[model samples]
Target: MDKEQVKKLRAICRDISVLYVEDDISISAQLEKLLRKIFNNVEVEKNGLSGVQSYTKNRQDIVITDISMPVMDGIEMCKRIKLINSEQNILVTSAHNDAEYLVKLIDIGVDKFITKPIDMGSFLSNISKIAISIYREKRETVLESRIKAQQNLQKELLNGIIFPLAYFDEGEIVYANSSFKKQFFTEIDAGDFSRFRLGYLFENKKYVSMSNSELVQEISNSDDKTYLVMDVNKKIVKKYSISVTKFQNAKGCLLSFVNLNALNEEINRFSEQVDYFPKRESFSQALLEPKKSTKENYEIFCVGLKNTKGFIDKYGGAKMHSIFNSLAKSLKKEFSAEVQSKELSIYLFETNRYIFLVEKNLDNSAIDKRLSDFGKKYNYAFGSGLPLELSFIKENIKNTQSIGDILENTEGMLYTLSTI
Candidate 1:
């Protein structure tokens, strides 16, 4: 290799730690001197056995060994090292050009091979290439770990809060929280949320009366008390006191919902005690108001009970209700009151459909494992080994569309699981 190429090789190998094994004292000394100049740490062993011992004590980034040795050969030592770490990079040096020996070394996962009386140029090029490969692998591993940690942190933040909220942009609903999904989007599929429009959600004629541009202008001009009147399942007209604020650096707006009844109750309490309170305006302003989106993350788990009608028919209404209550109690115990508290709710929809809304900071795998175990133990509640199956769907509360869309999606998934 040229001087510039040798310099580049030395730079690449500078930080790498090496383990070199050779039986000949003269050859070992010459190779050790060259290796010490290029590598940060160079460990030399007289035999394969000592090489394995040193490698076990402190694993090096690269291992270069001779095929012929006493006690243990290079092939045997490399085999042992591969068992320790399958990804360990090893380069073999051998005098014999025997096909069987070369095949054995390849079978043991040797990274590269160098001939006896090693050519300096070839050896430097191979080692440098291996070092670069190791560097890339390390960088990728670190990047993957960092991404995983960030995702986990987002999930944790989402699980900590309980409220129904949604974000809207350009007349479209972009995100909804767990409470919003359970309350409104209980029967819609999650993927279909992208197509759902914000205008179709409001039932109040006054709010839906204006054009999209006119409505956006009205909302942007003034921060007023607006209500979202939703015709939930075409059966009930549920009203929520909604507040809109422009999302920073974005063209869209954030819409938060506060239960009308809850807000009214707070207002009524404040009115009655107005005489005793000094900061009446501030206190009332803060009472039951919609919060700014923290973009929290949470996993939504839909728990469905199979064969509910048959179980109810055989066990009676009172017995079925008792079993459901018992199941809810068991679930609450497993998920803990501290994490969920009032957030864990069991809603009985239709005749045989039961959906449990659990809001907590848990990854899908952990939640699935716990529910699987819960299913095994809770099935006996039906008196006759009743078949209980559970399916879960996770939603990043920050990326949800509408509550109605979420409900529709969750119900659809439950229906598929029940049929299966």
Candidate 2:
């Protein structure tokens, strides 16, 4: 090829990665230098079998092979390479310009047919055309892959077990998955599917006017997921974990939903189990002496929940109990037996008043925040006492003036056993 022609073909090759398969070692070696002048990376394989291996491993953008070789012939190797990479850019080179062999390569998606005694000029021109074709093909492949990825993601989102999903365009429901329909028993007519509200499925007229636009907008603006609980017919619907995604092709929003009601129910049951237990003071009489050990401290810190009746009423008996249970579990996980609880020995106590003993140097702020979260659920306040030794802590519970005083005058539900 002339210098200018070679330069142009070289630029095209620079934009591509190619593989050459030839049986003749001397020919392959000489062509390697010439290919390197035009292409940045060229892989040369001595036989058809090695060519297939090289293509599979390196993901070659262009493949050029002689018609005949040992161990595996060009036809069989091309078939194998196609099985590995159906979109491979292939050019078949052969001295026999016969119709049968040329047709065979064409059928296997070969891009160019060249006769060898190898005319460098014609060869370079053919490679330039193949390079442009390969670039266009690659662009198409990328577009198809992106589209497939989006479709797969949509399928996965709609397939969730715990989440009831919906997608909104403006304030109207644009799409909903099987779980949403199943939950609502919604029979969506062709017209109803276009612009419908969540209230369409329920008997009551409560959520009919609730605007979904703001919710969708929130999801679009934030990168992380958001969650909230909405009341439906006076029943707390639990936490609805939501994610909003906006699409570029059109001004539409994707909304994802997770029904946390079951989780809330579990939390409620756990809380009730923890709350209804016999007063810990009953266990105080059997207090065992702390055994010295290397593994863990033999101390206990108690946390008390005082005046939580309002909280129980507001958050529902079940949910309040769940919150308490969660707190108790968290405390136990962090402090273990270094924690204990006992009702006051003195009968001058109140309803729903107890002392909790905690035994760790855990961050008081974090513990307080966790307790505060519980209080928020019940719409009440909690108070914590300073930590103290388990012995001093158990004894102080006996000094409350009255049940009313214990219930009403306590600082919060959370008290430190270390300072009590």
Candidate 3:
């Protein structure tokens, strides 16, 4: 090879890794040093068996092996590697120049063979050709992997969007967001929709003016106008106006759907406010009422909701209501024995969090014990998901410190415990 050829091959080998297997200790050591100088990574094995084991554990880009070794010969090793990856790049070295053996090596998918008294010029030139091939193949592999990664990132971003969204390629659906999946094809794969046009989804439902081919062409052009389509979700049909945007570097477009009626219904739900959480507000307020016995200090302990929206999204409103109601009822019953009904309050704090307040007449130790007991009795499974960021901290509500200040400090403590 010329100086330029050698430099080019070395540059390619600089990023490639190699695995060398041989029984000759002196030969193996010499080749190891040579391979290390050229390739980015070099792994050496004394025998064929360990070589196979090493390759299985950590695959390299190129493999070079001797024809004979102890425990397992190179023939069997080559066969095993070929079975694993038929396209594996391999070079074999042997002293014998037998025709039958050379034919066998070719059959086992060996790329090149070097004689025992190797000619340095021939070795460098042939190996350079293999390196060039490997470099080109690696670029293709890297390109494909990056494309897949980009697609995965796009899917994640689409899922974060609040409304139903889908992507089409050649007028066939290839990707759908989580909202679209839940609303329509929860059990079906996005690829299954690829065989049919987007208009196929509208059959047996709301009538639209455009034909499948016409709609597909219109969407490809994406004039920034909304088109009415049937949101065929399970057996129910909801009228959704879809906006299309042509995607750069793609032969298709992104479709976003908005159901005006559904949005209005959601708005109505948020508008209606609860005057009180049935009896919860009164219970918390009753604790602030003056006690007939003595003027006493108060101790507050709290459990908070981390992501209120996320919790409701995962567990639903019914489960949220049921668990909060149950937890409040349990806390009241547990602490009522030691403290007066008027002194114990399970208050509904910010964003549906619960704060337990009790007058300091009872032992603080007793309150801590009950809280710890409930946490353990549930095997911490109560918090596998739910409230009880309750690492019950004692915050004093003195003359100067407001109840809000006390609860805020406790909320901070609970947040730390939840993270830990």
- The predicted structure with the larger TM-score, 1 or 3, is 3
How accurate locally, in lDDT, is each candidate?
0.67, 0.59, 0.68
Off by over 4 Å in 2: 1-17, 38-40, 56-59, 70-72, 83-86, 107-111, 136-165, 168-174, 177-199, 202-322, 325-420
Candidate 2 residue-wise lDDT, 155-207, digit = tens: 67676644566667667776677665555433443347655455433233443
Stretches of candidate 3 off by over 4 Å are: 1-11, 21-32, 43-60, 66-85, 181-209, 216-231, 234-239, 272-315, 318-349, 353-420
Clashes of 1: 18
**TM-score ranking from best to worst?**
3, 1, 2
* Span of 10 residues, lowest total lDDT, candidate 1: 275-284
**24-135: candidate 1 lDDT, tens digit per residue:** 8988888888788778789999889999999999999999999999999999999999999999999998898999998898888885899989887788778888889977
Taking the candidates one at a time, how many backbone clashes does each contain? 18, 37, 0
Candidate of highest lDDT: 3
Per-residue error for 169 in candidate 2, Å, reads 5.8
